[model samples]
Target: MRIERSNWEQRTLGEFFDLQMGKTPSRKDLSLWEDGDTPWVSISDMKESRYISDTKEHLPYQTIAECRIPIIPVGTVIMSFKLTIGKTCIVSKPLTTNEAIMAFYPKKGIEVNSSFLAYALSALKWKGNRAVKGVTINKKTISEKNFSLPPIGLQDNIAAELDAIQEVIDGYKDQIADLDALAQSIFLETFGDPISNPKGWKTELISKFGRIVTGNTPSRAISDYYNSQDIEWIKTDNIVKDLLTPTTAYEYLSFEGAKKGRIVKSGSILICCIAGSLQSIGRCCLTDRSLAFNQQINAIECDVNHIPLFVYCLIKASQQLLIDTASTGMKHILSKSDLSSICLPVPPLELQQQFANKIASIEQQKDLLRQQLADAEMLMAERMQYYFS
Candidate 1:
């Protein structure tokens, strides 16, 4: 269905929807929170894509009543207005958000399409730093700032097309996730229990096969040390996703900064060693060039006899074991000693090469699916812009 851009009309966001900011109830009021049924959402619960229906925390009706936080209905547009600015999602169920989120309810006859709003918000060139306030920044306040929206009917049509493409993207995502699980299952079945490495192949501690180099962070006070592009710097947040190749989602650092922190050479495996990212313990990527990582990460230079990809797969397969062994507290951390003690199965070079080749084939297929998903999404976005200019 072709949509003519001229058919669409425009209006400010505030004109189309009633924007509601959220409030945080007093933490000291424990009585208000007991056995809460209301789903309470925070920025942490907001994913980059797709509506979030579940949250890690919940609140009681009493808390909701006392706080007077608005319960946004399903299909309402929710956006992160603070730390993670501009990211948006629709509510799939009745939920209340923290001060970090802004909820938008379509005004009568305006009929804002939730998915359209989400994609539009994602594409918005939001000036997040401008929204910062004293002490703690708030997204709710930021979302109140004005933006434009397309005509109601056009928005609906575009959203419908986008939603269809989104389903395809979702299918690809599901397939990738399933394939990853299948690979993990294969690893477990082939190696037996993660702890034992039961094939009884030569087992050796990580320290025996690689050189561990700890990372450091340059002073944040020196602003000149950072650059928009210079050297890729890996952080804990970048470890959550799979990367067949090294890529950083954020800004690179200057050569000086690279020198300040230990230079992580290309092909060296980067591992997260901090608390907040304990689950990212064994996450590894081969850097394209020498880069700097913060103190929370460590660079492991593999020996010539071992393939970097194979070691990464082995470590990834053992990630759960590492997490289970992590120290208990509000935060979980993997110490240098703990990392050094991790044992891995040493398969013959020929076998390792074959396994690497097989995994690469699977990864290539996954990557193609991912690219198709991306292209589909991009086409949808472009079509929306054309349909609702």
Candidate 2:
């Protein structure tokens, strides 16, 4: 059933809900923190597009009383109004968020589904008027925004439909995780412990199969070099778990910048050598064309005779092995020596091809499911706009 926009009533967010910001308890008062019974939510707890049932930290009962932080009731719509603007979630339980977060509590007689509100907030492209620098501690912006509200029954219906769609997406995500685990298990089963390949395949150093090319970051001093339409530059931040293609990245450099950094050709496998995200290791993407990478990334130009997909799978399967061999420090470092020693079951080209073909079919299925989920989410957003415009 389609609901006409004229049937819905409009209201400002501040009028329909009570917006409250949280406060941090004193760190020096350890006793206050220990005895607190309230769930303390940080920005990390609010996953942008996921349902949040529990927080990482909890505050003492006394801390809640002393701090005067309002206990945001269950069904409240919470959002990150600071560092990560526009990301929103609905609390499944009574929770107290950090200073960085702002909670929207629906006022009495002003009914709105928590899920619907969250979706609406998520769809909104919020561009705040003020420049939010990190100079002020606990700084946040919770402006009174407006949204269209349907009848209470209609709101519940919309939420239920979205919840069902979200469940399907969640199932796909769980399946992907399971598939990843299965792949790792299969790799380990085929190859014994770290040093030995159980299949007894002949071992070859990494340098034997490919040339290692270390990346360099073009000087950031020249601001004119960065352009949105420039050559795609891959960065460590662009690497996501199980992501074969990088859809988004920061700061693209000009063709001149690519030349200065020694442009990496298409099909070159990119590996991050940075510290902040040490666990984010293998990001082997077959770039469409030559592009620039930062100094922290190492690109491997594999021989054409060898399949790039096969190499990527091998690296992905051996991620744990590389992590195990990584040097212990604040940052895990995978040295060239460590990478060189990693071995794979060198099956015949025909067998590798067959395996790749099977994996490709599975990946295609995964992609279709992903696209379906995206479409559902888009439909939900459009419905929200119609009801709340």
**TM-scores across all candidates?**
0.75, 0.74
- Which candidate number maximizes TM-score? 1
| Each prediction's whole-model lDDT (CA) | 0.73, 0.68
In model 1, the worst 10-residue window by lDDT is 134-143
In Å, residue 187's CA in model 1 sits off its true spot by 0.7
Alpha-carbon error at 183 in model 1, in Å? Answer: 1.5
* Candidate 2 off by > 4 Å: 1-7, 28-38, 48-50, 60-70, 124-143, 192-205, 217-232, 248-257, 260-267, 281-292, 304-307, 320-358
How many residue pairs clash per model? 4, 7
* Residue 382 in candidate 1, Cα distance off native in Å: 3.6
Candidate 2 lDDT trough over 10 residues, lowest sum: 134-143
Candidate 2: deviation at residue 115, Å?
2.1
Residues 22-67, candidate 1: write the lDDT tens digits.
7778789777667977788888888656888888878888788877
lDDT string, candidate 2, 259-341, tens digits: 65357777777776655555765545555467777766776777755566666677676676666766767766776666666
Candidate 1 residue spans exceeding 4 A from truth: 1-11, 128-151, 196-202, 214-240, 248-267, 274-276, 287-297, 304-307, 320-338, 345-354, 384-389
